[model samples]
Target chain A: MSSDVAVQIDRVGKRYGRHWALRDCTLSLPAGRIIALVGANGAGKTTLLHLAIGLMPPTEGSVSLLGTPLKPGRPQTLSQVGFVAQDHPLYRGFTVAEMLRYCRKTNTRFDQAGAEGRLRDLGIPLNRRTGRLSGGQQAQVALTLALAKQPRLLVLDEPVASLDPLARREFMKTLIAAVAETDVTVLLSSHVVTELERICDHMVLLRGGRVRLAGDIDDLLAGHRVLTGPRVDDAALDGLVTATHGERNSHLLVRQPATAPTHPRWEAHPVNLEELVLAYLEGQD
Target chain B: MLWVTWRQHRAALLTGLFLLAAVTVPTLVSGFAMHEEYRAAGIAACLTDPEARAGCAQLLDQFTAHYGQWGNRMIWVTFLPALIGAFVGAPLLAREFENGTWRFAFTQGVSRTRWLLTQLTVVGAAAAVLALACSVLFTWWRGPLDAMSSPMRTAAFTVSPGLVALTLFALALGLFAGVLLRRTVIAMGLTLAVYLTVRITLEETLRPHYLSPLVRTDAQKAADALPPTAWVVDEGLITTAGNRLSDGDERKILQQVYDGDTVREGGAALERYLAEHGLRHYTEYHPADRYPIMLIIEIGLYLGLAFALFAAAAYLVRRRTS
Candidate 1:
């Protein structure tokens, strides 16, 4: 309920007929931070993002955006949260300027001049139909539209999944530049871990429709340690996350305070974001 | 929201306008020529003068033979509503889902319900206006033929004010099918099939029963027993025992009476035989005055169905997430 919490999802669940795509998912995404939602395909990342943005109602629990209850089709909640669905869907027949105009007409607080300027700076022609734009240009246009809404929270679902690496870098550069200029909180989902590590300060890893690990990247790294020592059973260590062993030695990833005492024979090293996320994801199965 | 709806559907709307003009220009030119011929031929005087019925019958027959097939060909215009439903209504929502722009549209500052309502209003109003225009044009086009027979018949009725309601119903059906199926092409196909079925059922099976026919029995078959504008529902022989002869029995009796003869004298002999057999000729008809009541009833039926379909489409839009 704090003003610092941009989105608070409590015990939310989404069901598709007999299957539950997301269940018992609870998270409080802090305002003004770039949060990465890391998950593989069909891991309920899209479902959770949709529920948070009020694109669809949660079947079981509640979602609160900017301290108010999330209601699908409620103008107040919808205006406060901007969303870019997967593939950055756009009207193919509309010119880029017309797409901008359409966004302006549909939203209450659209930054028309700012969006036009952004496109102009990017060398994207205003009169070109969106269908004719390159994949990267289309992504940039979709992002521009979402940002120009001046939303309090921005949600993107697998935004760069289909873009080539160079385009992906450019898309991230535009996104980061916009974030620097606004107080908007961002929550973007992706399966690729390394790309997110550079931009995201906070992280949530999902596995099999459940949150596997969530926290500040620095805090998660500080808490989890990778220990290597002579072959030993993992049962002795407290807060064990995952363990792998060879004939001569064993390695364990454990969650514990950074200053915690360790075994005299073992050497402990700080866990990186990718290693921490992958350890928990692999630990699940 | 209005601008959004217009921008998204302007192509379909313009296509509808182009089609309307395509049909209207020819109809307007031909309609003027037909009206000129009707006046020049003095068909109006024959309709009013009772003694003139003899000469008028021949003039009327000539007028009808010349333009009757033209009026009947206008029945193809009945497909206008179905086409509107298929191209305009079906693609209205189906394309959104098909192209996945619904996600972009619904997540904006406007609510989903408002967005949908705006679309329905703009598109529905455009369709209704086009249908009204068609009704006006065709009603005027078929005016000469209507005087020769009855406008209460299928070909004439399809172009009446009832067309407005039927068009709205078709559009609503398309909208509902689009939301249900989520595929534009499939929804269009479904809309055509369903629209034709409902239209045919109402026109062929249910139209006559809107009001009970007026029945008259005569010992002699009087040619002028029914009015000129009366819609003849059924005509047959009735026995003194109150039994109506089936069409097959009447055909067999007519064959026996005529005996392959093709002379006016054979009609007198057929009448004499019917009188001797205690059989009377019966005519069942709907008078011209019933046209207004029939129009009102048919319009009410289609509007009611349209209302139901629009409600169903709205409900699905609210309930379905993807």
Candidate 2:
């Protein structure tokens, strides 16, 4: 693994009773890139993010963050990582200022002013109880708390899954600004694929507790093409990830490096990001 | 970490203090009044000297008539520990897990073990201080009543150092319940149920057996009367053959002596009958001086259970996931 790699997992698997939430997951994420972890409802995206932040320990194998072994309940390992859990959980009874002070006290290098300034910029009251704030404001506070840690890596598990479209846009704006301001590597998990392609440079597609496809977005799209040609039951397409037969023609999403089709009767077209992800997911089924 | 713990729980701490004040103020007022009434009625000399007690029965009766209602109200203190356990201790962890905030807390620079310990220590200490204050205040307030009866009386016992241990145990039980149940109201309910069960079981069954009651038997009637303020556990009529006289034997003897008059109609006939039959009364009593020893044993038992529960809570926090 290179020094710029943010997270490394080697043969990691997590089991709950008899079911495997994640199994034999091996992936290395590069630093300073916004990575999207896209998967279906039960596709182990949250489990992988949890393992990276040491929220839960894998039943087998190892996980490392920024080249250091990640062990759950270790202060040193946790100090380098910041996480925003689903629903952006915060103490509902505490004032926003109290929440910020809480972060400052428990973290060694928390930027208290930075967090307060961020909340103030968003017009969130410092003395108001967090429960009274709008959901968007609460999410902003949660994100500010994570950013205040000055972490090397930030892991978010569907932070905007509960937000309105406007709130989602605002949250994404703040996140992109945070990335630009700091040299932090981000791994964001979401089942909503419509909004992610704009901000994410790298993608890891998961299905049923396994990684189906992972690479730079540009490279992944460049390698896959949809070929529409005459239907033939016996015909075989090279580098076929998935194929579908229509009434008069067959559609093939192939993973070949060539940009054009070799047959004269076929048409080749570039694949969009969502089509690419849906193809891989459906193909796996 | 300290600030974070306090910030997160300061409202609860303040609420506890408010409750402490609410209970303590009235107790102090009523206590001073009771003491003045006792001294003015000249009941102190009777309580201090057994001989003067004969002449001061009226005075003691007056004091009891005036203040007995307040004494009965003190029984409410038995539920104070339960309140602390349910509201303060149960929510310590259950609320975090229920609100999904443990993920936020556990990811801080401090480890989960340290975080739990710090919160437990700070909150436990606060509870201890409140418990200690209430214990001392009520003990001082109930001094006159303690003089009237043995300190082993249930009302007086409710305010002893034993109560402090009981509170700690409740707190630990609440924490353990919170971890196991992971819901505030449910854990609170479980804490109350478990604490009451243990307290009632120990008091009813295990307490009297802390030490064997002193037994006295003699053919004379004078030996049957137990010591002043001693707790009478049991009494029975023993025949010369060393067998207990059942109710049938007593009735037959009473019939032979009273000549068709029931024993209740004439108390002297039953006494005369027992004496003539060479039967003696065996009395089992725990003397009042055993108060301190019983206090130690009871407090030790409660503290022991509290520590075990605290260890269980800590273990669960370390091993279980959110």
Which structure among the candidates has the greatest DockQ? 2
lDDT: worst 10-residue window of model 2 chain B: B220-229
Candidate 1: tens digits of C-alpha lDDT, residues A205-253 = 8888888888888888888899889988644688898888999888888
DockQ of 2: 0.80
Model 2 regions lying over 4 Å from their true place:
A1-3, A232-239, A259-266, B218-224, B239-266, B276-279
- Considering every candidate listed, which one attains the maximal TM-score? 1
> What is the CA-based DockQ of model 1?
0.79
Q: Which lDDT tens digits does candidate 2 get at residues B127-158?
A: 88988898898899888877776677677778
CA lDDT, every model vs. true structure: 0.89, 0.86
lDDT of 1 at B268: 91
Local accuracy of candidate 1 as per-residue lDDT tens digits, B37-63: 899989888888888988777778888
